[model samples]
Target: MTESSIEANYNRAKLEADKVDLLIAEALENGCSFLVEAGAGSGKTYSLNQAAAWVQENKWAEYRKNAQSAVCITYTNAAVEVIKERLPENSPVLPRTIHAFAWEAIKQYQSFLVKTVTENLDYMPDEGDFARVDEVRYTLGNRYRENGVQYLYHDDVLKLFCELLDNGKFRRMFADRYPLILIDEYQDSYGPIVEKFVEYFIEPGAAPQFGFFGDAWQTIYQSNKACGAISSDWLKVIRKGSNFRSAPRIVRLLNDIRPDLPQTSAIDGFEGEVVVITNDDYSGSRRNDRNFKGELPPDVLRERLDEVTGLIRGNVLPEETTKTLMITHKVLASQQGYDELLAIIGDALRDEEDVFLIFFKDVVEPVYRALCESDHAGLFEALGVKRYPINKKSDKIRWHELRRSLESARNSKAIDVVNAVVGSGLVPIPPKIEGWMSLYRGDSSTLYASSASIGQYLGLDYQQFVAAIEFLQPDASFSTEHGVKGEEYDNVVFAIGRGWNLYQFDVYAPMITGQVPIPSGKQASFERNRNLFYVCCSRPRKRLFFFVSIPLSLEFRSFLHDLAGEENCYTYGDFLREWPERTIAACVKNGAS
Candidate 1:
């Protein structure tokens, strides 16, 4: 390994290694509220753990008692789990999701009835407790209907929670409970909610120490205004530049596109190609139709997939190739063109030694199971899947019974519903008494569907839903303009759809960097679209194959032509001057012509 590689790894370790110890050291040296800006993959949770440890240690030494409490406000339940997992073995940090933290703080000073009233007003109680809140929501819906107000989205739940906190009683509850606070993914948090914290939790002279971590680039998700207060001038800002997940070559390529990114040491020794694919060479407008002209067709996508998959299969390295991933936009993934490509890859890899065909679409079912928390057999019945290894009629009966049990629980006590869903982990249910109970009262919905789906379909329960989802996740390896984010994958194949040409600054240039100013609504859409495209192009680490359906864009074509005068890194045939007649032939043969 190079010296830079060693340094990169060391830097990563410094942020993640016994981070709590360093946090304590800093806290002991300065009692002033400390603000930390954590970047992507910068070990934000580890730092929080260290800060909590410091609080507990100093409280015992100086005050002969435990610190009042440390509150960690995170964006998601998954973030809560990550913090819990990273805390010191016996750490006392009260890590929780923002809503959970808020609820716990508010619940302490309020009566159960008051808390119940708050929950009813806001439809965010747990599944078992949904009825109480649902009743309130229904009533509110009727009242709102009379007033021309609409039903609620999930965020309205937090809005109601904030309303309750606006009352002095609940505000004091949070202030008195946790003395120090750390928030993760605070960027995605609701703005009003954070403002509430500043108003209520910020101690006048000695505010609680605060640490936060997130990236504005990836903050393309909703709620941009939420973390506005935590921006550079108001808060201490530190950028974690290194990407622990992607290889250096991949990072470099991505940086080339997004030059404003922070320079981090995380990408030191990694090397790989980041190819850009496009279709531009079509000389004749054989088909002048608006949809068909100079665009990627199904056959072209299929051919690219086969070619890309074949290239990777040729360059085998035991477990190394598993990291390559193919990522496309949500639209592309759902397209018939993508389906054809999958079939091509599948056929090409059927006899290949170590290659695996992982379709990103497969993740949907597992995620659905996670949401529903029910058996796949019941779902199959619900989805109208009749054929199974076991008797079809028997499975349908079991499905009906499971639905009946769910309705019963919904009508009965809320706890009864929770208990039933949390009871059965993953076992398939019969229509019998025990099966109905097992299927309903269970904590592991993901497990139940995964096991049931594989059992009935493949004759063996495969507890691999999580693995499968991860395996097919978006990764940073492909050359397609759309790169994956928030997930990683191995072994990527790039299938630049016919839409690649649309990325030319000259094509969509009017929306950005052009004389014609974009409309505000269209401007927002373009920004989001650009951010998403950039995210998708950075998901691979290994070999990259360019499967261009047409050719190159106007700017790209000019650039390539200019480059041809200086170097030969690419091929002339890679440029498309004419749409392949074969595509039309194939499309007609498949009856899509």
Candidate 2:
């Protein structure tokens, strides 16, 4: 193409983007709010950053006159960091997580928080119970207090905010202080609180002209608390149609699944690889007939995952470019070669009382230490082993790799090694760990102590916990659902299967295909899988592959083909033996596109 034509096309695209910007600017200028439904790869962060800069450039005078700041509320601290990094050094945008924003908004109103927690959440008899309460604090867990902290929590803050809503002072504070409120990832926000927030600002003349920026389809993390179909009429809903992250082919697939908010890829000409490998030969009722289903057992599932991974890595996406999103953590521990350890230690992490705290504890401190550098004797005694499992050449090779990589860990930040394990006195023991520890241990005492040490050693930090979780997760790097949210990769191998009691892909397929109507009662189940599937599919910037282990009937196969293009469909045998050559590798010869 001629330089003139190229420049002309670029100008046209820029003009198109500017039109959306103008609309948003006009909305804010006119004291109106909007809901930007950003589709897959639509550059939600870019749009938000642009809006923040635009408001600062255009409305800084008003903000200064009112002695207020433009607030950007995000769901996660990581997101807040992204927003802050995108804005200028002294940018006017005040980006904060919802919790921080909420606390800062009403931290001074301790009496109201105490009243709300005592009467409403704690179910205490009277507000006088908190007469000795020195201060109000917020936590991520259920609301409580030890000393005079009077800690509030996720829901407590909301409850208190709701109670404070009745106070005319709080309402005026909202009207006076925050002149603009831009909420990112609003879909993942708590539904009731979102409704209350929107209702307050959604009115024609509400102050702090607010806008919500998020996609309902990307509402996997908090689907239970998802603000469903948040009435677009009240909220001037706008769809950002440009997908800056994905290739043309990936965007098409995304749009096919999400017909409501179809996106147009911004890339000039990028056709990435897209494939859906299905298996039909796996007959039904294989694992004890219980309502007719066929599932790839842990062993077979591991094999297939490895097979497809190798294929994609060799032919389509590079190993570094590919990311595997494992859906079921239940089998992951076992499949990843740590289920035995997880069995005893997982139970010990926390009793049924406080699950999230233990989850937080698993969040490593300094770095991810995949293997603990325990003394050989402790290792052997922990697992009650007399000899190592280096019988086979392959075992010897892996054992050597483990030794070399054992020195490697997650991050570099030094943390005080609290509760440091001197020996294998923390790790839980099963036959696998027992055998593993046996290699290092001299006798049974060390083998049993290994189990004792498992919990504290792994709880070193999130990095360590993640390392331990996916330790050998099949000799391949894997990403957890929570860990990989909002992250992008060149290619994604999303494993979908009949695992996790929470999801029902077997039933979801029929409902989606129109063969079996999903009852209203089961809507949540359908949404749970649907949102997760969408989130996974949209993660890959270049290529997307699905490793479905559950039964895929003819209808489901057709549905998948329709969603991912028939040219992209492949049978298990075809992918294994004669998988079609990728056009992406053939055409794009240079760097990472």
Name the candidate that leads on TM-score.
2
Q: Tens digits of per-residue lDDT for model 1 on 33-112?
A: 44554444445555556665665565534332434667677776786787677666545467777656654554333343
Shift of residue 248 alpha carbon in model 2, Å = 1.2
Q: Candidate 2: lDDT of 172? A: 78
Residue 117, candidate 2: C-alpha displacement in angstroms:
3.4
Local accuracy of candidate 2 as per-residue lDDT tens digits, 227-301: 755774666777877777777778887777677776766655446667788765555334433422466766766
In model 1, the worst 10-residue window by lDDT is 352-361
Off by over 4 Å in 1: 1-67, 88-90, 109-157, 198-206, 223-229, 257-261, 267-269, 281-294, 321-484, 490-523, 542-593
Task: Give residue 202's lDDT in candidate 2 (0 to 100).
Answer: 68
User: Candidate 2: misplaced stretches above 4 Å?
Assistant: 3-15, 88-91, 121-131, 139-143, 146-148, 222-224, 281-285, 288-293, 317-320, 345-476, 481-483, 509-520, 580-593
